[model samples]
Target: MIKHELAKLVEIAAREAQSKDLIPPTALPEVSVERPQNPEHGDYASTMALKLARAARMNPMVIASAIVSSFPPIPGVEDITVVAPGFINFRLTDNWLREQVPVILGAGASYGSLDIGKGQRVQIEFVSANPTGPLHVGNGRGAMLGNALANILAAAGYSVEKEYYVNDAGSQIEVFSNSLHARYLQALGKDVAFPESGYGGQYMIEVGQELATEYGEKYLDQPSQLGAIGLERMLDMIRVDLANLGVVFDSWFRESSIYKEGKYQAIMDLLKEKGYVAEREGALWFTSTSLGDDKDNVLVRTTGVPTYFAADAAYHYDKLAERGFDRAINIWGADHLGHVSRLKAALTGMGIDHQRLNVIIMQLVTLKRGAEAVRLSKRTGDIITLREVLEEVGADACRFFFLSRSADSQMDFDLELAKQQSNENPVYYVQYAHARIASILDLAKDRDIDFSDGDVSLLATEAELELIRQMILLPEVIEMSAHNLEPHHLPHYAQELAAAFHSFYTVCRVVSEDIPMTKARLKLVQATKIGLARTLALMGMTVPESM
Candidate 1:
């Protein structure tokens, strides 16, 4: 809403300048209204004058003064000042900001929901970890990021579908199946050499035991032939593990199913129709270089099996065309960074709009226990599971920690810090603030106070205003997070809002002997609770009424 107001101001100034013949009609510079990093620069600042000065070939100060004089008084603007270097600053009325308290409370949970997405269908596919073992720490980061992004997009008015792409057709599944069979043979006291590339995690032993219990010694005699059935059973166990970790997939898209249903061949046919495929080296190759890939890619090997790229290309085609999604976002780990250009090339070569595909590469996460790092290797059965981390720090803290950092940056998961009972942990700090407000509100309710009839104007302290400002800007923050496809901003914004609320609680007396101010303070407190609750709810976390 503030951005809209600022855009209006810029347009008015641009028209006024054009009318005065100071600049040509078509030479009006693009104006940007940005919040200043420093509060002293006023609520919003525009550099239109500096931009127009270059085209007008005049002094920036003169242009700035002219624009300021031509500007009409806005209702919420306390004052408009022209600063040096042709920057026009606008200060907002404190009273107008304070009046937003009731508006926010009136909107309730729906206050921050915006229509920026315009009802476009968006599919966010993330944490599609191979159904081989329990989800490790690396997979948890993607899960939290994807789930939070989905919630943020929905709040910003997107028709969101959360999906998980299962790698049920890959060689990885063979390895998992062989591993289970080996574990079973070992459990039966048979002399069997474990496959060199097989998984060796202890969880596979459980899968083997479960298989033995279900069908005792039936599949063991036919190791090679039983792989298909064993793979299916192993995937079932993996699904159960993921559900236990609070990671649910709306669609478990099977890679093999895509190929089996002829979607893979259809995609190849479309690419050939678009003249993007060619035969080379006794294998079918995709000419991805034309679309900005580093080189051409192999779509099918000499063995006649389609490569992973072929399956992904077909999967994306189905997602975009047949599924009719307006956008598709893939949350991938850091190792997949090199695949971005190739995937984009594949989409482009297939005549699909490249803009429809958005790949977010989340940097790797390193988990530490105190000063020592936790080493994880699935082959050696030496990895930390997400379940273990969740058990240690808690789901709320684990989600908060993972969601707090940007996906582009590597994050250190400090087990010791997360497990601490002190305020050093950000999750506890924010939850404590919510609990503190609830405590105060409970106290007020017990005193038979009627806070519904309070005068919000009594909340005149700087800290109170700061808190109100944060609460009013909740929608804007959500909009930013959604547009950028980044949920890290949510936790950071929550912490800032909590800080403001805590400062207000410390300085403002909510249950004073003076009844008028006390009622007003109670109203402010209730509004804060509404905001904190909504903030936590946005991240899919519940605000405990009592902490």
Candidate 2:
């Protein structure tokens, strides 16, 4: 809201300059309102004057003075001062920041929510790891990021749907089925060599044992159709495993269903109608280069099997057209980065708006125990599953660690750090702050203190003001995270808020000897509790009342 007011002021200044013929009417400089790193620059600063001065061939200080003169008197802005190099610094009235406390307490859990999306229907597809094996640590990162993004969007007033695209019609599923079959053969005392490229994890043996118990070697001697049945059962097990990990999908879109329901053919027909498809070298090719791709891509190989790109293109078409979603977001691993350009080009060729498709490529995650690295390669049959990580660290710590950094940056998941219960772990630090506030509230209730009669103006300590300022900025942080599609900012913001509250608690006592100061500090503690609880809720973590 403060940023909006500043932008309005800049717009008015730009208009005044244009009317005076000092700058071209069409050459309005880009304006931005940001908090300066040093507080001495004031609460908010803008560089519009410097930007316009260069264009208008005027002195920077003179341009800044002109813009400041054009701004009308506003309620919250105490003073607008021009500094060196044409920077306009704005000092906000302290009362305005203080007034936000009651408003935050009143809004409670809904304080940071905004109607930015206007209830538009949007769908996010993520962590669609093939249901061939357990979800590993690598897949868990995307799961956490996608889940948090969906939550943020929903909080921002979007009709959000979280989906998982199940790859149930691929060679990977067949290999899993064969792996189970080999394990079954070994259990029946028959000599059978495992396929060279088949999955060899110990979990496959469990699937084989379960199959043996259910059918009692009945389907083992049957035809290859039994393998199809075995694969279906394996996928069901995989889904159960994912559900146990708290990753539930609104829709389990199977690749097989897309082909069986004629959607794949319909997408190919749509591309053909658009004249983007051509026959070359006995294969069907998509003219992606015409749409700004590096080269044309093969949609269907000479063997009549569609490539992965073809399946993906068809899936996206269904998401946008048939589903009637306003936006579609795909959460992919870093290995899938090369596919972004081709997919964007395919969407352009299919007559779909390119902006509607958003692909987020999350960098790789490395798991470690203390100083030693853990090897996790599925191809080599050495992998650390998500279940193992969750079992070792915990769901809360795992989620917190995964979301503690930007998605594009490589993450080092240290098992020792996460397992530690000390303040060194960020999750514990935030949770402790919440628990401390709860303790104070419990004490207040026992002492029969009435916080309603508190005088808010009594809270004048620097740390107390800083805590209030952090609480007031929750709405801004939520908006930024939602617009940038980054949830890592949430935990980082929470840590800063906790630090502010902790410093205030250390210096200012809530149960002081003076009743007036005690009651005022009680209100402050209540506000901190609400903010900390809200932040934890956004990350899908519970704030233990007595952690």
Candidate 3:
């Protein structure tokens, strides 16, 4: 990765300082390498001089100049300069940037793979929507975030698993079942009153109507098992909705199974043994306050029924302790913000490192058609279902818009923009670049011109070199995104890569007057195609050869 390479350069500077006795030779400070926000500054910048000046008791510029002057030559590095405020900047030469074309072509799909995670196991749990009804468009945001993170982590050499925790045994399922039963009775011309807490979605009514037709009046008196039947059907529907959104779970873990398999009791016993459990007001409480929580949380009610927190504690225990995963991540909606500190405390109380658990809260999403805001589903009349939106635009477009903003910020998705085939639609714009490149190469093949042995060193135009620079940053982008657990950067990076390719096409002719130049430019175009394809695949979207 470029960041790692830059760190090595800084280490060289540090060693030079040590050998000259500019600083203490016996001790060296940890080095931090970062990219400059302004491109004119340099490719990469380091501020170790400013950090070390006070300790060395010397002028910042003197320390910075010493480090820059003593640094040995690095390949592809044009010059190392000390800038204002004692910042060291490194710029790559044009030759080095041009030489990356063959490196990109040689690596192909594996261009951005890194070994940062060092093969540690990570589990990403997301979109675990209660299997009581169809998934809403709100749920789609979490799916896109989690799936993309999984792909990024795997590329960074982490053993990652994508999972969905099914809340099948929750109270929502009970209400959903009773609603279905009442609807079934109402459809059969019975005079039963609908329960106040029943699910009033059109989908639930349709399911009840189907049951009425399948076994007419058979479940009228004894509809006790209707909840189980409805839960399974909802689960099947949820699976289809996720697949439509281009997401797949490696495992579907059922919450009900945890209690049946004895893991729930095992966790509870572990907590009680550790003296983290106590009775308060006739209910068993977890001593979360002892670990910095606002108050204690109830593990079991006075009626002896386990709470969701109990199941959640057991689920996390199974993930880190039983399954032996090094890290666990849960993607939740913004409403779960209050649950973070307690969950962390619970994990620490159980003896596992709480820092290993990460909870990301995704803000809400609102769909807009034009000047008006769209909320209710025209079909369901209550919530906008994920399937409805996916079917309306496309899986590719839906995912692109969902990831356009950071997880912590609210987003307004423009429905009309998503359907547009113009550059206004970001997904369409990126895919068109890939398709345009394919057309150019196809035309080249008709004239018996091959790019496999083209002279890549001849690519010297500013556009060509800029495109090459952007292409080489894919590996660096992946490393940064994975390290920070943020995916909003991918969509932005894809647009930049696509724009670079488009700018290059407009300025440099690939099949022009100079045959050798044409051949060299073709190789550069081919490298661009590989970079675009790899990015689209990483986002779990289709790589359309012709859009």
Index of the highest-lDDT prediction: 3
RMSD of each candidate relative to the true structure: 2.4, 2.5, 2.5
Give the 10-residue window scoring lowest on summed lDDT in candidate 1. Answer: 238-247
Residue lDDT tens for model 1, 1-547: 7766787788787789779875556566667787787889988889888888877888878887888877887877877888898888888788887788888778877878899999999999998877777778888889888988988998899999999888888677777778888987777767888888788888777767776777788887766455666666656756665565455677878898897899998998899988888999899999988887789999999889889989999999899988999999999999888888888888888778989999999999888888898876677777888888878878887778888889999988888887884246687778888898899888988998988888888778898888887887788789889989989888988899999988887888789899999988877777888888887877767588786
Residue-pair clashes, model 1: 0
Q: Over the stretch 1-547, how does candidate 2's per-residue lDDT look in tens digits?
A: 7877887787787688667765555576667888887878888888887887766788878878877877778787887999998899998777777777777778877878889989999899999887667778878888888888888888888899999898877667667767778877776667889889888877777767776777777877652455666666756765665665556779888888888999889989989999999999999999999888999999999999988889989889889888899999999998899999999888888888979989998998888889998876664567778887888777777778888889899888777777774235688889899999999999999999989878788888888888987887777788888899999999999999999999998999899689999988888889889999988888767688887
lDDT of 2 at 392: 77
lDDT of 1: 0.82
Per-residue lDDT over 375-435 for candidate 3, one digit per residue giving the tens place of the 0 to 100 score? 6432333776888788777888788888778998998776676666323668888999999
TM-score per prediction, in order, is 0.93, 0.93, 0.94
Output the lDDT of residue 250, model 2.
Answer: 90
Worst 10 residues of 3 by lDDT: 375-384
lDDT of each: 0.82, 0.83, 0.86
- Which regions of candidate 2 are displaced past 4 Å? 14-26, 222-246, 368-373, 414-423
